[model samples]
Target: MKFLRKASGLLIAGLILSACGQQQAENQTPAAANGDTVGLAISTQNNPFFVTLKDGAQAEADKLGLKLVVVDANDDSGKQAAGVDDLLQQNIKVLLINPTDSEAVAASVKRANEAGVPVISIDRSVQGAEVVSHVASDNVAGGKMAAEFIVSKLPSGGEMVELEGIPGSSAARERGEGFHQVMDAQQNIKIVAKQPADFDRTKGLTVMENILQSHPNVKAVFAHNDEMALGAVKALEAAQKNDVIVVGFDATDDAQAAVKAGKMAATIAQKPAEIGQIGVDTAQKVIAGETVESSIPVELELIQQ
Candidate 1:
């Protein structure tokens, strides 16, 4: 009876030990390996720029054999916060966020910080949280480039309209700052009208129409993005105002086509694909416990026909 009891005890202990060992093995797997995932939260995929960014990230992830989980906020800050929460629940190793509203995304970023998930900011930045890295084009510089181009076209100074992006976005603020840095100095070139179109083509069209109603003599238009520029182009065409020099940012395919067709005068080419690719690469380094620069800037160029 004693011998049978000893054998039974040993068997139970062995089974428990074996189960623990299996669990430990599973825990030891590297996050980039196996089915572990990283999360990508984008401001919106409606824009071709963001779609290209997603495609770039997806391509790099596939190359590295890493699983990437993507979420589209559709330009909604509330939806973005909820999406971040969902990604956290899925045990994502890292989070990549392109914020719709810089200030609004702060709370979500803070939550990720507290959860010990490293965050990488893409395209736009977060106002009130710590980020492991930021990957984007230099909006300020791009804006300066656009302004310089505008100056070249309208050296004698003229009335112009500025189509703004969404309120509270870092990109908008920085680009506006750079534009004003140059335009403010030019006493001859006056911004007759400035309005926020919220980075939507439809909104851009409506806003341009309203601005034109009052500022019919506007000589040039500088849109913070290509979508707005394209919309402004349509409005100008409709109103039979063909002489206005329209300079846009983000040389998306459509914008490039417009430039080539002489519809848009110029645009700043921000390589969003490169930004997305570098973002994933940075995430991999972070996952491997490697240090990375706080800001990674992709090069920009002025694209014109």
Candidate 2:
């Protein structure tokens, strides 16, 4: 009888341990199973434009009750590839990339493709990868607008300089192409010196300073993005070339303020926040297995003083 009582107590303890183990297992559900999660890989958050883009995406994701994981590459393509790999390992339902360099980002995008994680490009397109949708402004048209403004300001066809963005970037290539399409046709207009500043303000200042040494009489300047434009403005200010018409893209707050202060001639507003919001919305549709546009264009406008 005592032996039977010992067995009963042992059986109860074993049953209790089994129940606790099952409860612990249930509590340790995967993060993805807790909620729908998506990943956003940005080229760089150091820039105000990309910061706003990230903010926009986060806001929308929060409203939809989704987990939005973000990673910043700091403008390094290799880091972006590694970041994408990390996101893929996290069981992300979708991946959004704002590539630092379009070509270099392809390997990362292809890896996402192989993992069956759909990719949606934001603000910039990726090369050699399949994407469910591309969310961005019409950069080519924005470039054309900048060129037209420069032409209007320099109706007599004067020498000007261009500060290009990062080399091998779709934004740089397309914007430069659009600018040339308009400026090259104007026989009176001349691009005296064009150089890449990698879309950085400090580099823009340095490059503009160097260009001034050779083309001091340049009547106008167009920078691919606002940071470079602001940099060029600083360089021109130091040289006291205040009358030079300087135009820029990505009408960031600083650039807009500069325009209002009469420091910059104009800027093309690409509505980065809208781009980010649309990107998340598109991701939702893609997740729902719904058909969406292959390319989604956000609005663009010219901001002038």
Candidate 3:
């Protein structure tokens, strides 16, 4: 009778141990039954644009009870690939990539697709990959808008310098291209100077300072991003060239304030908050195995304040 009792206790203890192990495994991930944990890796968090994207994706992950892993690539293509590899090893169910380079990041994206993790690209499109969705502003359209604003402000045409972002970036190329397409139609306006600032504030300032020396009659300046715009504005102010009209993209907080204060002429407002919100919403849909569309173009407003 005692031997029977001992056997019963051992069997019960074994059952209890097994149950505890199962619970631990479940706690380690966002999986529920057959559902899997989700992950989101982006190119860089150095820019506020990317920071907003991360926030939006995280909010959605919380609502759906899915694990969202965010890794910053630091604008390095190599680091971004490693981030994807790490996420895959973690058994991530979905991948949202904001690639450092459109074409260069294709190999890693292909690997993620092979791993069966659906990839949703945000901000910039990935070249040479089958992305589930691509979310970003229509940069070419935004560029055209900037040109129209310039024409309206300077009807008689004015000599201006262009502050471009990273030369090869799609945002920089398309926006700059659109600017010239409209300008090409107008024989009055002229591009006196152009230089690459690499989407950085300090570089923008230095480049503008140098351009001002060669083109002292500069009447207008267009920066591809707000950070660069802010930098160019400072240079203009220091040179006491307040009469030089300045326009910027990205509608960053400082740029908006500058517009309201009349220091800035206008800004192309990219709805970062909306972009972020949609990134999260789409990520959830992807995890649910529902198809989503690419070229998610958010609205852009010309803030003339």
Higher-ranked by lDDT: 2 or 3? 2
TM-score of each: 0.89, 0.89, 0.85
Worst 10 residues of 3 by lDDT: 27-36
**lDDT scores of the candidates, listed in order:** 0.91, 0.92, 0.81
Mind giving the per-residue lDDT tens digits that candidate 1 earns over 16-93? Answer: 999998887666535435655789999999999899999999887776657899999999999999999999888887
Model 3 per-residue lDDT tens digits across residues 1-305: 99999999999999999999988776643333354576667767777766777787777666556667888888787898898899889988777787777787789889999988888787777888898888888888888998888888888887988899875566788889888888779888899988998777888899999999899888888889887888899899999998778888988788889989888898898877677668767777766667788768888899986
* Selected candidate, larger TM-score, 2 vs 3: 2
Instruction: Return the clash pairs for model 3, or none.
Output: none
Error of 2 at 261 (Å): 0.3
Residue runs of model 1 more than 4 Å from their true location after superposition = 1-32
Which segments of model 2 are wrong by more than 4 Å?
A: 1-34
For every model shown, the clashing-pair count is 0, 0, 0
- Order the numbered candidates by TM-score, best leading: 1, 2, 3
Candidate 2 at residue 89, lDDT?
Answer: 95
Select the stronger candidate by TM-score from 1 and 2.
1
